[model samples]
Target: MINKDSVESAYCFLHQKYRVYEFSNSETQRDDIEFAIASYVNDMNKELYAHLAKGRKEFLCNHTTFAADMQEAINELELRL
Candidate 1:
């Protein structure tokens, strides 16, 4: 469901407001970004949890696994970008 539009929206939002400097550092900003991502992931996992409650084992597994993998890939790509 994370199509190009969603990615662009997230990237643009972060770029315009939350994106950090390359050399200068800020722990609070880092923490804020971490919190934001954690919150987003928590919300996503709640839907996965609901699916699990409904006995959709395959989808639950696939969704969780794919999400984790996608996050890792995105993290790597973010560094590269």
Candidate 2:
């Protein structure tokens, strides 16, 4: 289940760090950043999300995570968009 508190916490953090992101070229910047560090991001943004939907994150370095961590990341991404 998605933990509101954890998600909120990440949202708060991203808000604090990326306050101007939305006003800035947020989406483009995100794409550029991913482009620069494609290996790190798994290149799973809109550009590749279409083709790489399956194993979209395969390029990302594998790491362990609790469900809460995944939810928190999803929340942050959604909130940013």
Candidate 3:
């Protein structure tokens, strides 16, 4: 079973990562951040993957969905846990 600490940790880690990429001004930094996010997402579980995928798709298309997505995921996860 997924624990609260684990969920929070995952959320925090991804949140920081995306926030950094989101505000990045350098193309090289963005590329590196994207690579890092992709690598982390690739190893995530189904629950986390679903949230990240949704966020990533919307972010790519409109650039303003990942934060909300992550927030929603954490809220849901915390409540469920």
lDDT of each: 0.42, 0.39, 0.58
- Stretches of candidate 1 off by over 4 Å are 14-18, 21-24, 42-81
lDDT of 1 by residue, 1-81 (tens): 434444444445334333342222776765555555545444443433343235444321343353343344354335434
Which is the leading candidate under TM-score? Answer: 3
RMSD of 2: 11.4
After superposing candidate 2 on the true structure, give the runs of residues whose Cα lies further than 4 Å from its correct spot. Answer: 20-81
Per-model TM-score versus the true fold:
0.34, 0.28, 0.55
Q: What is the TM-score (0 to 1) of candidate 3?
A: 0.55
Model 3 lDDT vs. the true structure?
A: 0.58
Between which residue pairs do clashes occur in model 1?
A: none
Cα distance off (Å), candidate 1, residue 4: 2.7
Write the residue-wise lDDT of candidate 3 on 1-81 in tens digits. 455566676677666766786688987886676566556655556565565456454432233454455455555655645
Cα error of candidate 2 at position 2, Å: 0.9
**lDDT of candidate model 2 versus the reference:** 0.39
Q: Write the per-residue lDDT of candidate 2 for residues 29-61, one digit (tens) a residue.
A: 644433433342342344333322244353322
